[model samples]
Target: MNIFADFEDRVRKAVEAILKARETALPDLSRVAVEPPRDASHGDLATNAAMVLAKPLGVKPRELATEIAARLARDPDVATPEVAGPGFINLRLEPGFWTGHLAAILKAGGDYGRGRRTGHKVNVEYVSANPTGPMHVGHCRGAVVGDTIANIMAFAGDTVTREYYINDAGEQVNVLARSAFLRYREALGETIGEIPAGLYPGEYLTPVGEALKAEFSDRLLAMDEAEWLPHVRDRAIDAMMAMIRDDLKLLGIEHEEFFSERTLHADEGGKIAEAIEDLRGKGYIYQGTLPPPKGQAPEDWEDREQTLLRSTEVGDDQDRPLVKSDGRYTYFAADVAYFREKFERGFEEMVYILGADHGGYVKRLEAVAKAVSGGAAQIDVVLCQLVKLFRDGEPVRMSKRSGDFVTLAEVVEEVGRDPVRFMMLFRKSDAPLDFDFQKVTEQSKDNPVFYVQYAHARSAAIFRQAAEVGVRLPDFPTLDASVLAGLSDEGELALIRKLAEFPRLVKAAAEAKEPHRLAFYLYDLASAFHSQYNRGKDFPALRFVNSENGMITQARLALVRAVAVVLETGLGLIGADAPEEMR
Candidate 1:
């Protein structure tokens, strides 16, 4: 199905065989590569080995190229391999080569560019929002990015696990418990005055408190603070987590694991403590006096000796504290334990999708995961920058019941999952994005989600249009490989060229671990199809529906069908829908 890879393999072996047959010492072939020409005039593929080996061989690049091209002429897949521009081998494929790609596309259909699964297990963690509130707009980018990355990794052969880490055991949960306590009092028809400063003021929690009031009522009020705090915190945390899960599901994101921070240390009589102690045993932790912070230090900064990690040795700005002065483990301590648990679960590759504010934490956490896994596990943190919402070229007002925040459910309801996903991936993971609420639903090229979907719909429309004209489109039901040989138009050949580049594209994208490339590829493929579609308007004979000539119609229909297949395949990779009808 991957003809480019197949041809590249053939050419590689032929070159090596030709070299050995010439009785020349074998040069290292590791750096050699096969890639398409940026300009089509440069031929189908271009390689640089001849140019690279020219200086070492003490011969002009053209002379060496002539020698290599002479040897490559005998290969069946390559019709001609010409050396141009200082020994660049521009291989022009046979006439059947471009046309024959339709067979592979029809054979593979929706699975055309799907790569082999790596079989290596990986855990991807994202949207580990505090279990004290619903997911807001900030979660949308990470949710879509993480979900798409999981899909891409899975498609590329890795065993991917989507995980949602719930930080339900922290101080935030206790604060939420106290915040819910006030709402509980209010639900009992008792005025608790204005919601105090430093407490959650969002009205969304009113129902949570109302639910708690119905469940426990006067019982919690009568109980001691110690007894009531845990009950309230646990109930409130579960409610918030339920809201987060529902929001994610609305965005079409599903995680395999909902890991709890509270579960780690509670699993074995304080496992977090055990992990820290183990690190202490390994000389990774130490009590040291740290200097005052630089670059806008905290206002409450105090220089004192406390528990610290040897993070400086692992390439951090400085050693960070693992425990506070009150003998409580700092956030870094829990982080170390979290990754330790990730490794304990037998995952060697861990990826975390976090907001851009965590840029400072990336190096330290990567160093920690590497240290704790004993260099056995590696962590990749993909930081998603902020998403600025727009409407009519102006920032839209967002309300999450708080004055400023917008929930994930709001965006999902506003623009469904496809636009949300495609918009998020339309930019690099590290770049800030402008998401226009109004434009996403538009039917023009301004919206890539709509444009790509329209291309697939247009292809399907061609079939229906052909049928209406009594032009019976071929069903790819025959083995007449000779029928494909009829295609020769420049635009037709251009579409074939894009179709043939798919396998190499997938491999390159996988090797780079960047799913945004897949999005760009879909756009380029759609552009080619649109270009060809417009060209057919000027040249009536180039139209795919040739009722008079069945073979030409079949050949062109086969080509567009191949376009749809590749579109669906690429769209599926980035978690976007390939709709057959735009409306």
Candidate 2:
């Protein structure tokens, strides 16, 4: 399945054999990589092991490449090995080797490309949208990206926890409370005037107001702002979170935990104070005045002494204040506490999915991770770029219902969740995506999701035809690899090679924390499948179900079934549907 890994081992053994033959010392070999050739014409695989080891052994790269190639040709799986330019060793595997890969895939079923267990606890925080309003389209990209990353990490063996951080303790929630109170008065037959400025004016708060009115009739109207704010704030936050969760469900996303920012401010052994104390004892905390940031006039800044974290020592651009001049904990302070909570709960790896606006926060967050974990834990931040929704090449300016920007729910309703999620992941997370409504909903091959899903559906249709034609294909496991000997067509071989690359592709994408690679891989695989299917139209003998020759048909059927399994598994990871038939 992981042919690259298998060949890498073979290359390593060949190097060891050469070292033993010469009885010479060698340097580290961990960096030696056996990968696919840049040009497929070179070979099935290429390795730079000889070039990497040559200098340490005091030999020319070409000489070392020759020695490695000679030893590699002895491998039963390796049909040919040659030394190419710059000491690259290119290898082509035996046809039976790729054929056996089909068997491996069939045996594993949906789990064919997944990696072995790594036993690492990873916390992935994404789409922590403020619980003050319905989720808009702006939140869609980060939500899909984070969810896909968590899914890929789990498939690639890490224990993943999907999390959302609620901004409940912020001033925005107070504004939400005020917005709801106005709606509450309206619910009780009070004619409240136009919503005041600097407060939430969205009509989504009307229901929250109705709910408050139902609970206490008019008692809340008699209380002071301070007395009534907490009651309204909790209810509004709960209502907003419920709405957000429903919106996320439309896209098939559900976080395992929704961590509240309020939890960090608990008076009994407060986490914020505790986190600060932990850092203070470690000598990374100080009280000081910071210099004005670059390019800013001194008059434009207000200098004051405050509690600060020595984030500069851990690679941050400057020291960060943990408390504000107003005697309230800063946002960074809450972030540190939340991070410490996750760390104490046994997460060794932390991944943050943020928007482009939060790019400046990466280094400081990484610094906090280092300070809290003493460099034992790792932090990775993925800053998702903007997404511009377009319709027929023109940008969509507003949403009819929200009257501001398009809500994520509205987008899902327009084109369906499959298109929304797939198109969002069709590109890398950090790249700005142009989501065209007309293109994604198209039923043609131009749509990547449709093309990939059609591949699975086409495989199913082929099996149905196979049954109708009186050619009973054997179970996938019973299809002997030897039967594939009849499949000598270059197209068939190339398709098989692509299928064999799935395991390696999954590993590479997961290690890089980039799930978009899988999307691209599925599209490429679908193109190959579609191309091979089209070839059968010109050459009838290349058809998958040859009624007169059941053995070969059975072998091809096995390959088809494996492709369906992989396509279904891949679509599921990215939260897209792999339909049995296109609608």
Candidate 3:
């Protein structure tokens, strides 16, 4: 049970008493939201309920807090409630209530920390990187966030599908084709010179070239660019996509779909046409001149009327063009069709995980989705900022030209997938991240990945030690929740409080679309675990494995297992492995 929720019920009762006594007028209770104080010394739970209602009811905040506290003291669960610093109600949970939290922890286990599911259907689209190249560090952050979001959505009871949009029929693919053709020539036993400046220069393309040689070695030699280009392009794309899939597997990230952009325009006319037709029926599309982007407009800019969506009618900064001057659909046009397809597929909501460079696109995309769906579908587009690499405190060089930038595979190989995933999410998504190759690989407590993993390991170690003490630790590890009713140590109570907040924390972070929140929470919980473990070294009685008392050992071990479950569940949500032991 959520202690914060229980206290909220108490506060509501106190307010009802105040209203019944005619001491205060009915205040709007909508503003009532209880939260744990940032500083633990500020008390177990803090609320601004008195301050929120005081002015409306014509009373001072501290006075109102004192009144609320006096009435709330009647609650059996609360030892005392006091007014502190201008109206904050510092709730002190009763000893029995705090001690009983151990039972809650034992009862919850892995399911303890999971949030309630909303049953809302959503589509989480991410890592839509081009299939023309290997998965690199640039794609890592968004992929992790998106994958975690899908898992989080599942935990929250929403029907979720992980999707990857493949840019198969784009200008970039044409370039990839030409680059692969050079490899194809080399594969066909031709002594080709240095690869062209505009083409891909990676040795990874060697296989794509070899495949072409195997497939159409003789026929392509006789044909010129016109006949061979299309065949070469299609074959090369399929090869590159295979490489991308392999690279993603290294990081344990997978997608439920690999939707082709070509399918949007092939066979049955085009999805762009369908989307535009739907928009036209709703009167959103119109022939109008778009304002040139701020700062610097293109030199070739011409102020000619063109079909545009009235994006400003929603919340976009300016109206955007759906078509370029060359009478071709823009990428924005394609995105509109993609989003429309998502809604047509029956998603109640959708999330787009994009790189930070796409931050400016959030508003326009959200606006269009709302406009197109007639306010039915909601899309949240999150932009992940850049990750700057460091090695021994120096910046690692990154080059887009030579493919010298770090790949996600390289990072996962250098440091395991758990560290990479956890470190990538250690900060807010929009915030820039500094990933140090040296720091992550280091085996030290400063490394949160190792520290957190060590806590889990220590918990397991405690179970082992207890088992050696002649205590009958269950083989399958089932604890009776009722037996944990007498746990009263500060460390045990603090851990219980932290463990009991998992479900609430999960729901908050999931609702906020802030996966970093999970990372932060894990760090705090790990710190708590570490502190408690270290305390056992100083105070023998406080140790998890108490050989002198079998019942105490069982109950304490139960609490330790509860901590491990929460840690495992949280790490699992973010695609990080909870090591049974850390090397």
Candidate 4:
């Protein structure tokens, strides 16, 4: 159960009761909130009901706070409700409340913080890197962020669909085909020279070339460019996509759907035409001339009239072009069709996890959702900033396989999947992050991944130590409440307080679409657990396994087990592992 949410409801009800007794109209309660006080010393929970509602109710802040405090003091779980500052109310819960919550945690185990299913369909599209090459470090952050978002959203009760959009119909695929054709010729013992400057130069395509050689042998060598281009392009896209999938699997990511962009252009551009017609019927499509560039005009500036989508009528900065000067549908047209397809599939929300470079596409995408869905659906774009790799303080620039950038597989191979996934989410997705290879792999508290996983391992070690001491921890199902009476130590209570925040934390992080918050919260929880363990070392009475005292020992073991359960659940949400042993 979310104690904060529970208390928030109680606080609101308390105010409503106060209003009812006075025969006054109840003010809006939406602004009222109950949360853990910023300073633990203040109290267990704090609320701003008095401060936010006093003016609307025509009452003084402190006067209203005193009234609310008196009403809240009636709760059996609230030990004391004190009014502090101007109008804030701080609540100190009874010690039994924490221990009882710890029992609830054990009862719930891994499902302690999981939300009730809402069944709202959500499509999260991430790591849609063109199926042209292996995934590079440039795409790693968005991949992890997107995957974690889907995981947390599912845990928070939404129906999540992990998706990858393959840009296989683009000019880049044609370039890839030519690159593979060069390698194919080389594979056939033809004296091919160095790759052209415009073609992909990575040797990763060498395998694709060899595959084509095995499938068609020298027969492809005699075909015209027009005849063989499509054959090579399709094969090359498949090979690149296979490699990309393997790379994603290295990070524990697997999309439920892999959407091909080519399908939108199929049936003689039927889908794109349909989307345009739909928008046109709704008065969103028209022929127009775009204004010139704001600053010094670029070399390609043209003022000719073209088919356009009146995106500005919705929310975009400008009306967008639907067709290029060459009469082919523009990329924006494909985006419209793609969004329409998703809406038709019954997705209420579409989340796009894109690289920082795609920040300009946000408004246009939002306009598309509004126009095509007729305001029935919405789109949210999350941009992941660049990740700069460092090896022991020196910048790492090149990869042997990727040529210009580090491959995601190379990063995972060097450090490991857990470290890469956890560290990628260590910073806010929109902020630039510097990932130090050495620091992340270090086996110390300074490394967040190690620090958090060590907490789980330490809990396991506690149970084992208890067993060695001939103290069999009682099963949660049969444990008695009296067994937890001796768990009144400040350190023990503090850890429970931290554990109590998990459900609230999960809901907040999921709603904000910020998985980094989970990473930070897990670190804080680990710190609280580690601190309590260290306290036991200094004072024998605070130890988790007190063989001489069976009562307190059972209580502490229950706490340790709860910590391990929460750690495993949080780690799973972030696509990381909670190891039972650190080594």
The best candidate by lDDT is 4
Residue 270 of model 2 has an lDDT of 86
Question: lDDT tens digits, residues 9-72, model 3?
Answer: 7687788798889865677877876888888776688888898988888889898899898988
lDDT tens string, model 4, 1-583?
Answer: 9999999999999998999999999988999998989999999999999999999999999999999999999999999999999999999999999998898898898899999999899999999998888898888999999999999999999999999999988888998999999999989888777777788889888999899999998999789999999999999999999999999999999999999999999997899999999999999888878898798864434588778999999999988888766678888889999999999999999999998988989999999999998898968899999999998689989653335778999899999999999999999999999999999999999999999999999999999999898998789755777787678998889889999999999999888899999999999999999999998899988899988888889999998998899999999999999998989
Candidate 4's displacement at residue 99, Å, is: 0.8
Clashes of each: 2, 0, 2, 0
Q: What is candidate 2's lDDT per residue for 29-139, written digit by digit as tens? A: 898998879899998999999889888889999999999999988889889999999899999998888888878888889888888898999999999999988999889
Estimate every model's Cα lDDT from 0 to 1: 0.80, 0.88, 0.81, 0.92
Prediction 4 global C-alpha lDDT: 0.92
- lDDT score at residue 233, model 2, on the 0-100 scale: 96
The TM-score that candidate 4 achieves is: 0.97
Q: Give the TM-score of candidate 3.
A: 0.94
User: Please, what are the lDDT tens digits per residue for candidate 1 over residues 1-583?
Assistant: 6665675566567667766887877676665666786678878877776777767656787887787777778776678888888778888877687777777677777777777766788898988888778888877888888888888777767888999998877778888889999999899889998778777877768988899989997778898878999999988988898888898888778899999888765854277787788888878888776788878775334477778889877767778787766576777788898888888888979988889998988989977875687778878888899899887898966654343677778888988888888888888888999899889988888788888888999899988887898876666735367888899898888888888888777777655556677777788889889888987789888887777787888888888888988888888777777887877
- Between which residue pairs do clashes occur in model 2? none
lDDT of 2: 0.88
Q: Higher TM-score: candidate 1 or 4?
A: 4
- What TM-score fits each model? 0.92, 0.97, 0.94, 0.97
Q: For model 3, what is the error of residue 445's alpha carbon versus the real structure, in angstroms, after optimal superposition?
A: 1.4
Best model number under TM-score: 4
